[model samples]
Target: MPLTGRNFLYLLIASGIYFLSARFAVLLFSLEPGNIALIWLPSGIGLLMVLRFGYWAVPFIVVASYLANSAGMAAVLSELAWLHTSTAALSNGLESALAATLMRRLLPEGLQSFQDIFPFVFGVCLVSTAVNSTILVVNLVMAGFFAVESSWMIWLILIVTNSLGILLLIPLAQAVLQAWESRLQMRLGDAARCIALFIICTGMTWLAFDMFAGFIFLIMPALMFLAVQGRKESVYVTLTVTVGLTVALAAENYGPFQLQTDEWSRLYLLSYLYSLIVLVLGTELYQRDLLSEVQARQSWQYRAHHDALTSLGNRSLFIPLLENEMKRAERMNRAFALALIDLDNFKSFNDSFGHALGDKVLKEFAQLVRKNLRDIDVAARMGGDEFAILFPETPMSEARHAVERLRKQVEKLTIKYHGRTIQFTISSGLAEFIPHEKHTSDAILGRVDQLLYEAKRQGRNQVQA
Candidate 1:
């Protein structure tokens, strides 16, 4: 979400779409038909646009509001209606602008995920909606257009409508946009099946809403089906069908909510709010659990491939890495070197100092290898006192110098063990991998092992190349 001239254009277009949709919804669901919408969407659109673009988009709110109000008024009243409604529309523009500004001031950092939606819903939504509603009521009544006795009722209606719009519309829009960005191409069959399912569900919902309101319960299977599928498009489509049907049915007073005409608005409002919350939270948590499972699996895989004591790559990981490096080197026709390191007098030292100190020596030696080698090099614990290092793109001469420096670093190391300072030395064997003179990983490994044995035989604390 960055700001550009093109982004400003998109925001303006989006504001128009949101304004038109809100006007349409209002016409359908207005308690006093043809005058005002029970739910006004401009507030939500304003906040959302500000979040997506930047503060510059706030002026679009004024234009959308002015046009929406002017058009709505022109359809019923004379041109003079614009004179009165313009002031009201100004409040709306200010309402939306205030909502967006408050949201920014309140959530400067913004939400990290849907999981962090509560505080935002509470603090910013409530306060901003209150500001917008109050400004609107005061603005209209002061202009002598709005009546005084019904002011409280209008205030309450505005609050509920604005809050519902913010809560339901923002996340729904987000899910749809996310699906679009995922670049998932639908196959012919997939598209057909999804559309067919949507039509069937819509038909069922229509029947339930028009005739047997209890049949609305039948949509639950489809609802759960879409939710469990866990695709953003699926979720957004399901919400569209469900919300569309509910609004249409409730508007006609032909649904389950018709049983109590006076309570339909409040009850349906709460129901929509609750339904969207459940759908959004369920989708987010389900995806989070899947991600957690993947991360946990990766953690176990890492532990499986690493030496537990030294926290270095063990035989399992090291061998494959070496093989892969060899293949890559061969492909590029580059040279690399491998060094096998064995701790000198390690067996006798462990016998004298106990296995605990022996584990310490192994860990310390791994750290020394890391500190000595270039970032391009790979180091691993072959096991116990044995280790290996791969120096990518290094010649035999460079490898020898690097290994000698590591040997010197190891020789200078000191460890405190139970009131005593202890020290150890390592003997290393080096071999350079030549691309033209190719060999299997096992052949290279076997040659390095032989050189390490020769180094040990010649007397410990020496490096053989």
Candidate 2:
């Protein structure tokens, strides 16, 4: 909220944008009775500024609202114009600040899930807009701008128009802001596809509003497709464009909502637009939540089963796989092999070169194992410096040859860490699972451990079967 150089710059930009949007809305969508725009986009702009810059934006909103309103009303009201314009500006600023404050308190996470929609619509949008509308209408009646009897209708119109402005514009602006801050990069094809979908949706929206009302329903599917397939920013932009076009066309009496009265038509149009936004955008948010949940669950499962250092299966995953493979070999009347491998003098190596190099050696060794093994083979890191492998449907001779090849590769593997050339070798024990042997995983593993110890005794960097 402090008026630093950056804050001052942002305030200037926000005020400029708010004033321009206000002028544009009044020029295009203003109704006769009170000169109120059917879609008051400056309300949204004010709210966004307040949300982003906190209470520092309130005075700028007031100044921008005063400038925009006073320009239009100065000729008619003359001296009393200052009072009316000042009241309107104060009301607009208050609405934005209050709405932003409520949103920060009630929806701290900011419209992330389906549960957020109701609170945002009712608590922030309706509540704040209603306050602004009430204050503005009361001020107008006091200033002889409208009859006391018509204050209720004018107030309702203001609420609907301002609420719709916030509802439509906030999401679009937020999406664009997020994309900008993240520097989101899209492939050329994907960007093209998104632009194409947006254009198609925009065209369809024009047809729906300008030509036939029945086409309105058809536009939703295109928007839905855009929501599902395109980026979040694109989807919000498409929705905003369609809604803007609908309002513009309706203001000119071109849409299907050209009913008995402009007020009724506006109400009908607002209803349709509100439902359209909620259904499409709500669905998109729900889908995003579901995807995030699924990804988090998958990441949790992967971390649970895999070694964080080597990305190989851990004991938890490897033991079950080994047991399953043993059962499969027995059921199919086939033979398989298991190997237990350990790095020679790993503790002393770690003491000499530190765990950083030790970790590099382990990762390199895991990669080597994966490279030498077949698709059907299973490899895992069984805690520090020890690894296990299951060679399914393989004979003892073939398994020994595979282990020997792996041992030789580990010997040749060199890790350059901190300009130090570090080389490590592995000692492994290979055991075979024959059909009808009825051997358990623990029994096989125990025999393999003994062979591993034997290999270590004979001399390191050897495979003892």
Candidate 3:
């Protein structure tokens, strides 16, 4: 399936939201969470890209990391802003791109479970963070942000904490967002239930706030709803909790419990950043996982009904299609036809030229029929040496013209076996199904089979109705 422009926009928006939330978390807490390192930063976004478009994670991670480092350096360090920005941007962008690529290379050949996520996060984000942070601190000293004498200590601390934080919090944030999204999807197509859940979850989050404790615990209950019911419920739960916390915190600051300037800044920025990043990355990953599931299912269905060798519709697929056409013809009082084509003297060709040559002939014959047939017409291999074509909404006269062309073209198929050129001709038996006049698809097909036998009897390389 094609990914639309809207899909790309959605992915971009989701990643942007997550990056903003990460920044918010830093600003509000005044103390950055230790676990941001664990959750996998842009990797979550990259994972989503791989899932949705299958090849977009590389660019998405690069841009996201670059933007994140640029913004973070500008906010936290004011002096030598350009120097910090350049160094940070390079570290961040390279780390994210490399992480995405590395994870993609190590990908398991199946859907991932909750258990698989932690290892992926550790390997990609945590490892990348360590390397990137080292480069960043080294650059900082080179650019004189810190003296060469003290840079080592600061670099070590920065690398350790940042790497650990990324590996921890980023994964949690991603998981929380995913849980919430699953809750939301469960209520899909039910506007009333969705809105109701939204209101209720919001109310609950509001009631759960305490003076010293943060609203972080609210993510737990919300995740429960998502796990049990799906994304629709999770969205309501997360939204309600986040909104309630925001309102509660904001209202308190203006009253007798007014917060200091730094505190207020921290409160708003912290929760906002954390929520945004987790939500966006989480939702994007969830959607991508859903897309992957759907694609796998469709692929399985296609494989089940198609010939493994040639990818042409197999007998299993063709039979039902033929039946459908027969029904349509009955309704319209029109006539359609089925053709049973056989390669003349196929056994002799197989014996003389070898089975490999016979197989080549079969594949070439299917290809020739594909070129000759219209999209509305379906051709399938019944088995070795036999093929069938079902012409929908076609009368006897039109069917004959189409089948004759196909027959002529197939006769021209040549194969090289054992360094010798071998050619073959085909015979076809065509029969028309006249709506209610023919009671069953089997009956019509049986008539075509008889016609095929008669053609073979009259001598190979002929079509008889």
Better of 2 and 3 by lDDT: 2
As a TM-score, model 1 comes out at 0.59
Question: lDDT by residue for model 3 over 347-430, one digit each (tens)?
Answer: 997788778777888888888888889988889988888899988878888999998887777667667777787888889999
| Candidate 1 Cα errors over 4 Å, as ranges | 1-8, 29-35, 74-84, 102-114, 140-149, 185-201, 262-266, 269-279, 282-465
Q: Please list all clashing residue pairs in model 2, or write none if there are none.
A: none
C-alpha lDDT values of all predictions: 0.73, 0.86, 0.62
lDDT per residue as tens, model 1, 1-465 = 567779977987987876786677767756543244555666677778777776667677767777767766666554467666676666666666666676677666544344446655776667777777887787666655568886776777777777766766665677677667977776777666666666666777788766776666666666566555445566556665565566666666646655354544545644654565455545554665677789999999999998888788899888898999898889999999999999999998789998998888888888888778788888998877889999998999999999999899888999998999999899999999999786999999999999999999999888999
Each model's Cα RMSD: 13.4, 2.6, 12.8
Candidate 3 Cα misplacement greater than 4 A, ranges: 1-271
Worst 10 residues of 1 by lDDT: 31-40
Q: Once all C-alphas are superposed, what RMSD does model 1 give against the true structure?
A: 13.4
Candidate 1 Cα deviation (angstroms), residue 82: 4.0
lDDT score, candidate 3, position 158 = 48
lDDT of 2 by residue, 235-297 (tens): 898888888887777666647776787667767877888888888778778777887899999
lDDT of 1: 0.73
